[model samples]
Target: MRRALLAITGLAAGTTAMVVLKGSPGAAPVAQDLPAERPTVVPAPAGPTPSGGDTAGTPQPADSTASPRPGRTATRAPTSRPSATTRAPSAPRTTTKPPPAPTTRTVTGPVVENEYGNVQVQITLSGTRIVDVVALELPEETAQSDQRSEQVDGRYSGSSGLVVQRQSADVDTVSGATATSTSYKRSLQAAIDRAN
Candidate 1:
């Protein structure tokens, strides 16, 4: 029995030794006919020649994983992009204003006669404001022979500023013509009121 056990032990040791000698159990194995991990060197794709590009070109496969052919334009590569500062600028808002008022000028006489036909008056207006009043060209019947031709008569009884600014008008002498002068004064007042 010992002899048989010894024989079994010897056989097991011999098998282990054989495996080690074959470079598998104890040492790293040597791969037979194994391929190397070299990088794939595929070519670029072909395209139409641009205005100034070279004419010689080769076509490539459409699959993205396939390498591009030599002398081919790369369609998938990124070209140009815009910077952050070149967008359109914004504008400010604005407002407008209104127009001004109108101005006026002076107007003068349409000479008029009064009742009993002895006195006359003329008026001047400065834009609806009475500026002058005058008694002019009186009749001989209401005037005295001794009174000067240049003398003013019928008393300035209207707006003092308006009457004083006027050129004095001659007085007419119509005997018992006091009502005529009173009428003349009333007419002058009417003209001034109209202007106002």
Candidate 2:
């Protein structure tokens, strides 16, 4: 039969190479058969050691106070400890007075020509507060007078710059863009008469 099927496939490859060279019957113990011991070194004291002068290389407090010295690592002692009682020195602080300099200003107005064309406004201020009313020349000649001067410069220049900022340059006009709200309130009353 082909030499007995090649001798039963060489006896199942020599019994899987002798169970992979006879290894695992559990397997762990080999560091020179194991039992050495000597690592106890302790010595960490440093501060109050002048007592018996020759404590060799000083550092000995570890006889296992619940195991911490195998390479020395303890550190956490700062939970708020400063109260021996002498605290009477704190009264010198009254300085509080600095906030007045922003009267801001910026004017520009007088171009009022109109019939759907030259307006000009600017304003700004801040302290007498018109804050911001910018229309710097409006009616752009024709796309329906530039879409009715950008619909009264965006809905009556913010409600006529908050009514000429709380009624300052005397307010009114903006109804249906009444001639660009009376030439934007006569160029915001010549920039509120040059900001007073």
Tens digit per residue, CA lDDT, model 1, 105-137: 333333445443544566765445455555654
Error of 1 at 34 (Å): 59
> What TM-score would every model get versus the actual structure?
0.29, 0.26
Best by lDDT: 2
List, residue by residue over 1-196, the lDDT tens digit for candidate 2.
9999999999989987876776567876454432223344566675777685787666666554455555544444458965889687999999988988888878888888867778888877777777677787898877877887787777545535554547565655556667887887778887887887
Looking at candidate 2, the ten consecutive residues that score lowest on lDDT are: 31-40
**Candidate 1, lDDT over the whole model:** 0.50
**Candidate 1 segments exceeding 4 Å error:** 1-116, 142-154, 157-177
- Count of clashing residue pairs in every prediction: 13, 4
Candidate 1 displacement at residue 100 in angstroms: 9.1
